[model samples]
Target chain A: MAVYTEVPDSALSAFLDAYDLGTLLSYKGIAEGVENTNFFLHTTAGNFILTLYEKRVNEADLPFFLNLMEHLARRGLACPQPVRNRQGEALGRLCGRPAVIVSFLDGVSVKVPGVDQCRALGQALAALHAAGRDFGMTRANSLSVSAWRPLFAQAEHQADSVSPGLAARTRADLDLLESAWPTGLPGGVIHADLFTDNVFFIGEDLSGLIDFYFACTDAFAYDLAICLNAWCFSPDGSFHRDRAAALIAGYEAVRPLEAAEVEALPILARGAALRFMLTRLVDWLNVPPGALVQPKDPREYDRRLTFHRQARDARDYGRA
Target chain B: MAVYTEVPDSALSAFLDAYDLGTLLSYKGIAEGVENTNFFLHTTAGNFILTLYEKRVNEADLPFFLNLMEHLARRGLACPQPVRNRQGEALGRLCGRPAVIVSFLDGVSVKVPGVDQCRALGQALAALHAAGRDFGMTRANSLSVSAWRPLFAQAEHQADSVSPGLAARTRADLDLLESAWPTGLPGGVIHADLFTDNVFFIGEDLSGLIDFYFACTDAFAYDLAICLNAWCFSPDGSFHRDRAAALIAGYEAVRPLEAAEVEALPILARGAALRFMLTRLVDWLNVPPGALVQPKDPREYDRRLTFHRQARDARDYGRA
Candidate 1:
């Protein structure tokens, strides 16, 4: 639950004055996202989401996040619509943090996503990639291949404490991914963090996608790989082949993958596991004495890394 | 922002199966309340609040909390109306904790409350006291006069750390309050914890009062005393005379306080200050290492207690 900032009532009142939203009736801090403070707000005008960008979000990237939502939403894609203030600006300041109010999307995220649910997410993701292809602005995926080494360095000394030899395996994986990471296969604004929680559905229909905090310009297939690791893996860390096939097939229906993209899946999947594992490891090691949130176990990704280490091809992930 | 427990997806799905609320469309952990896991739940039926009682709340007294909201709401009290399942039970279990779904109330809480807002809150609190006069079921105010000493005992050894002479002064005040604590004041279920955030408003109209987790059978005037301490204090700990007068007048306009209740106001206010002071001090001294919430500065109440210690009568609180 990502709510690190508290928006005081005075700050909220002054912030809303910049917009045409009627008197604020209710605002609740939503425990979603790991990088921003979100409030489920209801005003006399209507229901909306009030997001305050926190320390992790770059202030300069404000336009990118807001515009992407506006761009996708305007194109009939199911995502939040950024609400502009009376000045026609989507950005504002609240409680000394960058803030934006976006129209609320209507959908619930499935926990243990089924084969059909995975297919819906896959299609929604491909749709998101297509809609963001022409988004005009760009943000480099900060946690991509080149960034893994620095993240690993912070956790390297303590990594083995999480698991014996975990640091060495991670360092070796980072070296290989940096040297051999695929290039030039359909780069665009990808929902790089498309965890199941990021995708929302109303039964079989994918209603919307959220938490675009990690949305950045990266290989579209890398986004697909993240999903295979996030959505297709059972809790016990075993790969679910039918679910993976259904997901990839759903993506192919929207935007078919090139052969190079398919070939890069195994390595990309391993890189994705390593990236999450490194961050989780750092968070686990650095969690302050009284931190409110229990850090996600880095070992969960360690187990996933072990699986990806053995897969040699897209065939292992059941790509048809 | 109090979210103590996380209700998992499987648990939520299973819990909702017991409800007739159309389809579970969305449920996000809402950052509200200090003692329960509250989710802003949206389903095909409508929007509601899902609360899972945590350890701080006694399970045996849940029927009182749930039924009080029901009793108050039935009497036109603007509060969350507890939603009952098909079994006619307004209570259920979620994540192995006692849970209940309550109808959502509209209105936002003010930060720097003024005279008119205080008056509205005062009137509403009085109404709540009157409405709960015959609530049949009674729960003792666990933090009432008799309980403050033990709570103080837990923090007494560490109390001086909060202020130069706080621990010694607190012990002296406790002895005075205990020996002089008045009885024979009109008693009923009082909203013992009527802080600003617990009351919601639309413009100057009090739309609702919420968070009945602290409701209990206590002196009616004592509820007013808590409001005086809560709503009439400035950030620098100075009392706001106009707001205090407005609040008491609003209450008197509804259920007039008897002379004995009025005479007991100073001690009641002092006791209220100590009640909060003791809890905040314990929380301050014992906050777990990574606690998500910063404990309220016990010194805030320490300042209030200093004022109440010298207040001779209700007149000092702007009770004309």
Candidate 2:
């Protein structure tokens, strides 16, 4: 829910001239992506989304994100395909920021996803992983296991201020995750932050997946682990095992989990919880001045960490 | 830049069931209106704007605003006509707040409007006033000249904090406006808040006028006064007489201003400035917790007030 850059009318007209999107009819700054400025564009040709990459997005990675969308869509994945300009380039500059236009995907993201939606999400996540198997580009997961400890160090001093015992518990969890994090468990490209908000649904069917900025080469089971932390938890911090079972079963139906991947699920889930908890804690501690977005409560992930600690196997996640 | 209410998927589906808008393909919360939740809805039927009226708008005035849009569009003015549901109702409750869907208008609002654009705006504004003459509804301007004094009182204590000597200068201006404010100079339904953002244009052609929440029965000259303060001022607080002249002339080409209305322009402009200044000051002083929309600087209007103070007659506004 942000518009970090304001594109002027002249700049917009100039920017659109390079593309074959037809005459611009209307465009509005959409409260969509948090890390970039998005304008929902209406033109004579069709509707599209114009994204201006903010400072948080690496300019060098623009090709990776745009090309990956094209790659996924080419493989029958429902995602926004980047519209190239007359020069055959998907990436360009607008208002001195790297920008691209993508075909608008049709669906609404559910706030509290139902079990069916979770199942559909699981299927789509597996499909995405399968589609990216032969993609030409590769981006290492920046916020994966190795980054968690340093991220924790930045927020360590103030972690307990969020909750009475958050600091000590976080330190213990970090030590556990660092010591026991799994390797060689069917690694490939994963939508690392496949939260409910990133998956759009039309009724019970998943229509599209969006915000591929966090897409990276990582273990496929770790992606499922991230989803368990994101989608299987209720507002009361209770894990909905039915939804988890549906999600995991839905994933296995598409691409069956290997024995090692199944074995690594618990620790990966714990690591996923810690990864989010550390970031949220840091954001909670240092919210920028006049930021419109309220930093999510880090305690939510802290509770997930507690749940993952006691889970003994993939069966505890309702995985059949 | 506001979405105060979170409309759920089931609620949205049920809400759309009442309308013939076809299946909702996509909807994104738009950062458009300041006082309401706005979503740009794209459906099989077509694009439309879904507005959820926030607490700031009076529920009793819903009919007036919706009907006025209906009336204006019927008279061939380019504006968002309120779409009726199957029950023939234009307004319904969504997320426990009154909501209305209007036909989407195609055009971009200029951030820094050119002189030709100003001329188009003036013509459209006059057309709007003429079109609304026969609309069988009346609403008093909530933030008109009479409301400025009490609005000021709310922020008077902190007025100087916004600008040095602002409190003292505002009191003097209020006295002048109250004493010299003209009466019986051709009143009609006026778009009282016709700023640059509210008027959309494609190139130099006025495409649409929107955000009619501020529309009310008021002096037509006062509407022009608001425009003069809004569109005719440069970024550095300097007035552009050529742009002002073009605006008034373009307006007169459609609906000629009476001599008395012309004579009243100077004081009307001053009153317009005071009205916006007081409201902005109060909003600036008392911003609600976690407010997404930044309160516009009250000092912009204060600067306009200073310019209006020395303005002698309509001639000063480049009215030929």
Candidate 3:
């Protein structure tokens, strides 16, 4: 729905021309996303997704996103690898926008992922982090610890509308996070947006991961925090200790968290909640009418941030 | 940064000519939101926020939003009241978009809100819910329980690359929510997007609330669930039991939750989380590269949803 680009049919045809994906049978715009122009293309070769980079995407970062898929795919992560053109370029021009074609992965996103699924996601994430250790590319975490205040400052004038004492509370949290930021933890390319939709699965088995646009070089524990927030909670703002434990065990099995990282989970979760709350709050206030994109409710992240503010221990997640 | 429309000087002048806001000294765009084009306006009358409705906001709902603000303000809520023109019209054209002028409340949003502040917010929110009971306007909750699946289904295909088991899990959650949706709770106009940034405070005192774009007729308990998620969580996705208790107590102090409502908190929280996660997940796969709008990390809602799934007791929220 948020197709900001007008990728031409010719561009898609060109991609088909270059790639070894036999013949294109059909292409239809996937009408649900808020960012890129996505076309679900059915070809004699196989089903694939053609994504035209939309405005919010950085052209310069295309390689990292494209190559990360390739890198992960090579490591048997079951992700959709970018299809390279004849000139050996994964990036191409489609509908006048920067475009790439990826294999259409099969599987539904788990709406109510079980504890085992959460654990699998954790393990897969750890494996991805481990594999990213040598990806030879790096991007700064745009939504990292340092970006909170400035983002909040941008909305300070109307901050009262979001919550009473939000600005000050955020400032205090920022200070706390800054002073107590975990240092020297395991670091690598972190999938900053590992929500349920970004990961695919079949039944209890994990399938693949997608949407690495927010991938960045940050402390691996931050990724764990992201996962803890993503996978270990139910929809009603309650923490599932079992799921949390399963997820943590899964991650620790692959790449054990450092003592400092484990200790910082609560605070890190708080930071992550703030980061999302700020962004969502800003978005909520500025949703553009006529645009197909849906404005998210900022309160969701606000609740998560509130939860993290009181989170005292990892065991609080569940009976350890 | 996502200013959908630029309000020119002429548009402001025309608006001033129609409204009784005296003279407009200057107005400039505020670049903190992704939904509406907001301008900080200084007039002889007072400081105000000039908002041009952006996408995802329905034009038909303008009167409901404007009137609700006026109603709340009239009822002694310290929120921004929409200014009407001579024709008794609150809606107008600015920068080729639907626009309105709102009296900006004076106060700074505290970044580090204390327990007292949290309690105050809870009380204020309860007052807001109480105020909405007889506002003479009603609009269905756009993010109600029934809307979650269709929203997620819209973006389901695009999310395939994220995790292997995401799709099935999402389906499962949807099925569960559908089967377990609570029927017949107290219903009223709710500030569905009440995050910290939307609420303001003067020092430790409550100032006012703003941004009523997502206000709609929904179950009051659902709104509470939203606040519980927004106000009770830390940034890192852990539950803040104290704040949760403070907030719920504050809400109960004004308008107590029904026994059924208390019992349904878990599912309500799940529904709320699912509502947001679906929206964020949809946004995640859709963000365009060059748009001023930032893509929210869907993982944030994923964490909240995870929390809701495991929520067992209100005591876990510091509520007895």
The candidate maximizing DockQ is 2
Cα-based lDDT for every prediction: 0.87, 0.89, 0.76
**Which stretches of candidate 3 lie above 4 Å from their native place?**
A1-320, B110-113
TM-score of chain B of each: 0.97, 0.98, 0.95
Worst 10 residues of 3 chain B by lDDT: B24-33
True contacts kept of each: 0.64, 0.63, 0.00
TM-score of chain A of each: 0.96, 0.98, 0.94
Which of the predicted structures, 1 or 2, would earn the higher lDDT when compared with the native? Answer: 2
Best of the two (1, 3) by DockQ = 1
How many clashes would you count in candidate 2?
0
Give me the displacement of residue B158 in model 3, in angstroms.
3.1
DockQ of 3: 0.01
lDDT of 3: 0.76
Candidate 2 chain A weakest ten by summed lDDT: A196-205
| CA-based DockQ, model 2 | 0.69
Chain B of candidate 2 versus the native chain B: what TM-score?
Answer: 0.98
Report the number of the highest-lDDT candidate. 2
Off by over 4 Å in 1: A288-292
Clash pairs (backbone) in predicted model 2: none
> For model 3, how does the per-residue alpha-carbon lDDT over A197-223 read when each residue is reduced to its tens digit?
778765357878888888888989888
Candidate with best TM-score: 2
